[model samples]
Target: MNTDRKPALRLENIVKTFPGVRALDDVSFEVFPGEVHALMGENGAGKSTLMKVLGGIHQPDEGRIFVEEAEAVMTTPLHAKARGVMFIHQELSLAEELSVAENVYLGELPRKSLGRVDWATLYANTDEILKRLKVGFTARTRVGDLSIANQQMVEIARALTVDAKVVIFDEPTASLTDAEKVVLFEVIAGLQAEGVGIVYISHRMEEIFKITDRISVLRDGEYRGTLVTSETNEDEITQMMIGRSLDLSRRTARGEVGKTALRVEGLSCGSLFQDISFDVRQGEVVGFYGLVGAGRTEIAETLFGLRTPSAGKIFLKDEELRIHSPIEAIRHGISLVPESRKEQGLVLGMNCRDNITLPQVSDLVAGPFVSDGAEVAIFDQYRDRLEIKTPSWRSAVGNLSGGNQQKIVIGKWLAMRPDVLIVDEPTRGIDVGSKSEIHNLLRDLAGRGYAVIVISSEMPEVLHVSDRIVAMYQGRVMRIFDAEEVTEDSLIQAISGIENGKVA
Candidate 1:
């Protein structure tokens, strides 16, 4: 609304499609010079599709793009760059083996008159760019050795190398810690000061409120609305994004703690965790809350037989059990939906249907060959149950977005019909609607008498879904609160060891 400011880029009536799905339809928005405009939407809500169109990764079937009020055609990434548009992808794309300086100046490296690589000029120039962004890592260091946060900083530095005027960042803070997020905010502010128009995309509400000046929402491949960040609350934006008021209130009145389904006595995995103990009963959801390295995941891995407990006993239904591998755990009706969905949960090369039936494919098969009809029928049930958004079961699992891939993982585990289901970060990188569906699915599992163990860093999720919460600190069971006694404030005090600090 500032008359003094000129618009840097504008997208008018963009339309794009692939196969049977129209990924983007008549979407329009504008980015002003030196301002942060956020693109907010559900996973398949046309946000990614619009960005790809802008970056020339995909040409729009219909629409117009303008730069500085002049019509422009961007048919390739280089063309977009020529108009001063740079895009940082959500998936980290730095060459791990290359040095930070080398990556910063990768394609457009400074060269001598004889056409030789100018290492000295590259390092000197990259160092200045890194310093301007306040990145502490040495430019000469290999990017693979740096943390995820630092690696992202290197990617941003590469953008500066291009002399980019309009920068688009997708899910920039998805992996950053709280301290790292602060550093990123400072960097973004610095870029804005330099008159770079920035388009930021993320699902974290607090982040959008903090870093964005204007917010745009897209739903089902169409532009929903745009709002000024100063006048909006999370509920208002969420309503526009999801097209309804969200019942985020998740405190359930659990009937009673039924018979014990899982019992771990004196569980230990050497130095990872020592003398851990817990009990999970039927129709109960128990949450494990901890920091990154507090050994919460290690405990889940041990229980699922990914790691062997140095000394402990696991009992299911009052019968002692021995779990030496994931297969054995599955056979004993214990399943794990691991944290890293791509690396551990689903096979990217396979289709959604195959990924769902991977665990118990043999059971669905007849003779020595897999029954194609039986496989399709079995997968269709889960695909429908999980509300997976795919044109067909034949769609490659890798092609689906993060939330859809997560549903496939959940479908795979649910097909196993496990007595105890352990899920780690169930809603990470997913949208509000998908998150609600997943939560309902977990509750349904618990209602059907399955013992569910959820591990999450989001306090709202833990407090909402769990019948009883277990707070893990320094690899020990620091505190446990029943459903009736747990509140957001109390849970924070228990997990952080700070009772008087501000939680709300």
Candidate 2:
């Protein structure tokens, strides 16, 4: 808490560039020992780029890293490791089929003079590390059998094995439950007490304010500013992250929701969801709210035909529509911008133009060939409308920022011209500016009379964007509230099985 604490790690005038983008432009940051320093920015604001440079995943074009007031060389993960720097990423990299012991001792398993593996020592070491991190799962359990929260704990345990002095956590709680998050926070606090400097990267404002001692903001590969956590507020941090203040009140009230465009009656997928029914009226935005693993995604998948509803009926207007596959759903004027956009939504190797036309390209094709001109006109329209930041339509989507990639997904769905559109966590990893853009686009679509269904874990987002909000718990609709009538407390209460001052 002292202002005079010395920085354990310092990045001086760091510069990194990709093919068409300068990922980091003279960005500088410092982290003090025994303190939690949060790296704040929206997606593509260069937070991750700076972290990668420090972790030795990406070599900077120009910069100098200093550890303990001495210049350090971080050319590779090994080099970083040797300097007591370790990185734990959002996506875990543990082998599921392997036992915890095997994963912990991965390539450097203990051995005897006879050249035989020492399984006993490996398990013992794994157990010791897991205990030190306070992880509960057994060392013999398969990683695949563990929950996402526990898998993340295993990741932390792995880092502790090396006795790292500086640790970097990138979006560590993106998929963790509240209870799991508490455990992770406890471990981090413990590390801080041990004088281990931590760099925390996250999109959640609450987490940063709660955990960090100092905060740094990066925008478009440039260092914006750094502030003490006690001296800054969320709005200030958000403004710095996006280069402007965001008007969170831009979503206007749509006059009247019309007749139902899509209806789910007694929808049940047995273990996934049961007796779930909701009606999405034209010109209305409805949100499905729940905690992770609360069946929100399963319901969306069922509606999109990724999973067959064990028992239910889907009505598109007056006629019952049987959705057996995604193709059938598309034919019935339904399109879904799935969660995990990078993995399931867009083809990584393909260009933006190609992805936009993927859902409905037949209209742009001549007798037996695709019409490049037609595709260009269509892609250009949405790209411009969505304000996607990219070099060209020919640019590979994989090369774009996470926000741009999400815009591409939305553009792809728009190309389909669906009567009902489903977007899961539409702004999951986007920055404030991009989040506002995407939210406004969805509002515009609803204003144009498209039935929009948004599923999100962020409570404020649901309250901000929905015309009607449906709270789901244990795969069933717990309660429904008009957006205007819903407060954050009420919404959380419904989702958590509390209502009217008692358990529902």
Candidate 3:
């Protein structure tokens, strides 16, 4: 794809600092036109900070930016927009309260010569862009009512509307499905045909090798290296990102598995999932594998007492549980690491120490006063355990990256020392290093005689981490397999609902 053309965007000697952290230091990279360049790195390795500097959200203390062959000073997002630089963030920027057309042309709405809003022109233009992407959505659709995939497509349409020269996609497929991802790839191909330079940031290795033409690795705010995609392997790129290769192999329990820690019989929660029965034993890990709407999350929520089961029985140590709230579940030594950490897990306005200790406030109480020293001591403990990278315990949870925030969520529940731990998509947005750490930690917890249940959409993750695999489809249990008996193909078939020659 290299055509001897100058890079569409270039950053030279870029340096940015945040208080005590040097987010980026002399990090330089180039993105050529018609090329898909992947930015690879672990969390807190300066990938997001570097992208922010390019998008004009953060000014570099020292560096130069070049658009094509000329220098450009991007002091604000609007200035970058004028230079044809667009960013599609993982967390979408669309206003959920507005219609699709309204969000598309929010600031630069079409106006008639009579100083009135041109409603017809706005919807027409939005429709044209949607059709161009081959996406099935109307301009009048409210963003709040749309799925995550549709919302992503609308974000892409906005970039194309601005005629973006250098477009950056940050973890774009974190919430997309296989079918939706295919459409996204097609759209990217269209952009490539138009000679648009793309900077893609994702933790998915398969996506990198499938779509990227070249790859660049960043670590600790410095440029590590760049490799041609065709000549590189996942191991090599992963090493460059983390300074070492990570191994997430099939693991066995260190000690003998114990008795049933938790059991569910005839668990039915309305139409979400029905007749679900499973058991988690001490020193064992159970993995629930399914697609987005396949009811895995609903199952986990019910176990955590966030959802009321209509007809079912939950037993802990063979004793029936009448749980009606999260407080009760935690009181019975059950805790859930929720799926959406930003929304369901942590309180963003609060500091890291407080969020980690929020669920265990009772543990830190001293009669009429909640102890600050207790919170700080607990914070120090988890900070060391999780390797959470922040200036201090006083730092707001809102300011940390997604990966770090997830660690705080995990730490919050771990502090409870629950007998049964249910983690829903525990490593959703975490980096490879953090993921490996969490994976090992889970295994350790089980080895220490705690029950662990992991629910994930990633096939390899489930296959590698779980002692047993529980496959589900359309809110029904398909089958369960021991770790050694499951293969990726069989798992995919089960997840896709193609069992016993019948597709459910």
Candidate 4:
């Protein structure tokens, strides 16, 4: 793979800083043509800052950027694009209200006779790119109407449209289903065949191993080391990224299962799910196992009052409840830590203090307004408990690392002191250490007499964390088994439509 080809992009001695934080310190790396260079780091490890500098969003205090063997300086995003550098951000950048074609060609639309856009050319070109990406939607489809997976494809198509040379993918597979991830890997393969230099940033170790040629680790704003993907193991990369090995063992049940904290009877949400029934005990973690489109998230959303159930009845302590909205659910002591943290969980513009106390605003309010002392006390308590590493509680949540941002979302719900907590994909794009921390936190929550529901696509996580597994397939409850009864292979088979009787 290494033909001594000139690196497509290289950085020499990069340095960047923010208020009170030396965000990047003398970082350096090179990504060659036809290579997938993974960028690995824990939260606050300067991964984002370095990428921003590469994308021309942040000007490095000191560094040399070379593009295609030529020294180059990216003064603006437009300049980077002109240099054939494309950055697909972790947070999507599509204009939701516009069509996929329009968003793809945004700010650089084709012109015809200086009067009108060349609509025919735009659609044709976009359609070709969509076909290449194996996207199931047309370019004429509105961006807002597309699912997160499809929206991501549109972003990829936009990067392709420019014929990019050096492409940066930031957590590109975070929201994708397994099937969708396969398609994305195919697209990446196609790009690689063209000798495109790729900077792939992902928290999923498996993805990094599967797709990357080499990995560059960053820790605390300093360059750690780079290793060939084939030569280094997960343990080595994880240690380099986090400065130590994390204890990833799943905690057992805190005590004997208490009374049933929540139960769902005949839960049906149209075609999303049907006749789903389950009971979660007070001191138990029930893991929902299913693939994409298997109605797991739908069931969680329905239970959290984000969606209306058609024929289901929910009981808390054997008492039926009519929860028509999220407010009602929260009022009834049920909370959901949603999958998409940035869009649904926390307001990025808000500070940790406000975000953590958002769910319990009513309780924190005295007379007419919120009591700052009360909010501060709650923030301080959970901040220490959760180990949210932030310079200040008032710093914007968006500025925090992905792990800390996720903690803020969890903190927001923990403040509610809910009897039932549902966490969906809690560690989606988090580092291994962060994932372990969040998993332990969930176990602790379940230990505290709260029924906890964990919905995850990760087989290892589900098998390790849950006392019971509810396997769903094609919108129906396939089977429910004790954690001891289902091995990883068996559970995966059950979730993939194999009968429980057939599974060992």
- Per residue, candidate 4 scores C-alpha lDDT tens digits across 425-480 of 98888888788888888878877888999999888788768889899998888889
How does residue 264 of candidate 3 score in lDDT?
92
Give TM per candidate: 0.93, 0.94, 0.96, 0.96
- In Å, residue 146's CA in model 2 sits off its true spot by 4.2
Per-residue lDDT of candidate 1, residues 1-504 (tens digit): 352676889999999998888899898999987889999998889888898889978999999998888888899987888888888888788999999998887777889989998889899998998887777787799999998778888877877876677899988877776666787888789888888889999988878999899999999899999899999998898888888878779675885567999999888888888788889999999999876666889999998999998998999889998989999999999999998798789889999889998888888768889888987987899888878888789989998978889989988998888999999999888877778778888888898898999999788888788998888766777678898887777776766755456421
lDDT of 4: 0.88
Specify the poorest-scoring 10-residue window by lDDT in model 1: 495-504
Q: For each candidate, what is the lDDT?
A: 0.86, 0.86, 0.89, 0.88
Q: Is candidate 1 or candidate 2 better by TM-score?
A: 2
Candidate numbers sorted by TM-score from highest down:
3, 4, 2, 1
Clashes of 3: 0
Give the clash total for candidate 1: 0
Candidate 3 per-residue lDDT, tens place, 283-388, comes to 9999999887889999888888889998989999999998988999999999999988987999999999999999879878898999999999999998988788
Model 1 misplacement above 4 A? 1-4, 131-136, 498-504
Candidate 1 achieves a global lDDT of: 0.86
Select the stronger candidate by lDDT from 2 and 4. Answer: 4
Backbone clash numbers for all candidates listed: 0, 0, 0, 0
